[model samples]
Target: MEDTQVRDTIRSNIANKKHTSDKVMPGFFLLMASISVLTTLGIVIILVTDASKFFSAVPLKEVFSTQLAPLRETPSFGMLPLISGTLMTTLIAMLVAVPIGLAAAIFLSQFASDKLRRLLKPLMEIL
Candidate 1:
């Protein structure tokens, strides 16, 4: 009877421990997730503040003012060059990425053998 009581007590203790651990696990995960979100928000705020300061130093007149005719001689903002350069770089990057990405997809889906696929899938997952 004493042995039975000891066994029952041990079983109950283990069950209580498992229930407590399960409850605590989600709280721990929530804490980690909240920390990650706050860190990301902090980084974004810092970047925005830095960029705002950079843009604020430039004269608004230079940014928004339109050029007059050559005879009238008003200041030109000429932001078009910067816009065009950004577009050109973005287009070039897309052009370079699309073909390589498509080729990789095709090879993985159509050409790779089953064993190779299994091996590569795990490798890609680890990466």
Candidate 2:
């Protein structure tokens, strides 16, 4: 009888408990998300405004010109080399990383025991 009464009391308490954390958590997350978005926008606005000022002061032709200037002269600002380098590095990184990442994921999911998988998954993510 005591066990039955205690179980009933516990069930009632569980059912009656207000999920206040659920209500508060979304507000906290939304606040954090808004802060991040606002910060990004602020940075982008500063960059664009500064860039506009720079572009206005400097000649467009000078920026895009192909001839590499002599020492003691302003270096050519042609974007091709920088852009190509970025693309090449991106391609190389993807080629190397994608296969390794996929293989690790496959190994973790298929070969590892549940406890080992749980342990390794978080470690891999942190790395």
Candidate 3:
């Protein structure tokens, strides 16, 4: 009887409890979602409009040229140098990181206990 009365009282208290968050959070989330959608649409519209303007005046070949400077006097727009530099950096980083990451993964997967693996997996990902 005491247990039944306690449970009923707790249930009534929970049923009556109301938070500001319960009222405001749904509307806040909806507003944020709409803003994100509007922002994406606006960016796509702007990019298409400006891309059409740029491509009308410039040839696609010059934009993708492998040579950094195609002409002596003309201003260069070639992206090969930037692309190559980025690729080189990525290669160097991978060369340094891949072996270490693979060794750690092998240790975690092959040897670590289930509890340790579960705990470390998220920590390693964060690092």
State TM-scores per candidate: 0.59, 0.58, 0.66
What lDDT would each prediction earn against the true structure? 0.79, 0.84, 0.88
**Residue 114 alpha-carbon offset, candidate 2, angstroms:** 1.7
Regions of model 3 farther than 4 Å from truth:
1-23, 69-73, 113-119
Select the stronger candidate by lDDT from 1 and 2: 2
lDDT of 3 by residue, 1-127 (tens): 9999999999877766656558788899999999999999999999999999978876888878876674768755678788989999999999999999999999999999999999999999997
Q: Compared to the true structure, candidate 1 yields what TM-score?
A: 0.59
Rank the models by TM-score, top first.
3, 1, 2
TM-score of 2: 0.58
Q: Sort the predicted structures by lDDT, highest score first.
A: 3, 2, 1
**Clash number for each model:** 0, 0, 0
Q: In model 1, where do residues sit more than 4 Å from their true spots?
A: 60-93, 121-127
- In candidate 2, the residue pairs with backbone N, CA or C atoms under 3 Å apart (3 or more residues apart, or in different chains) clash, namely none
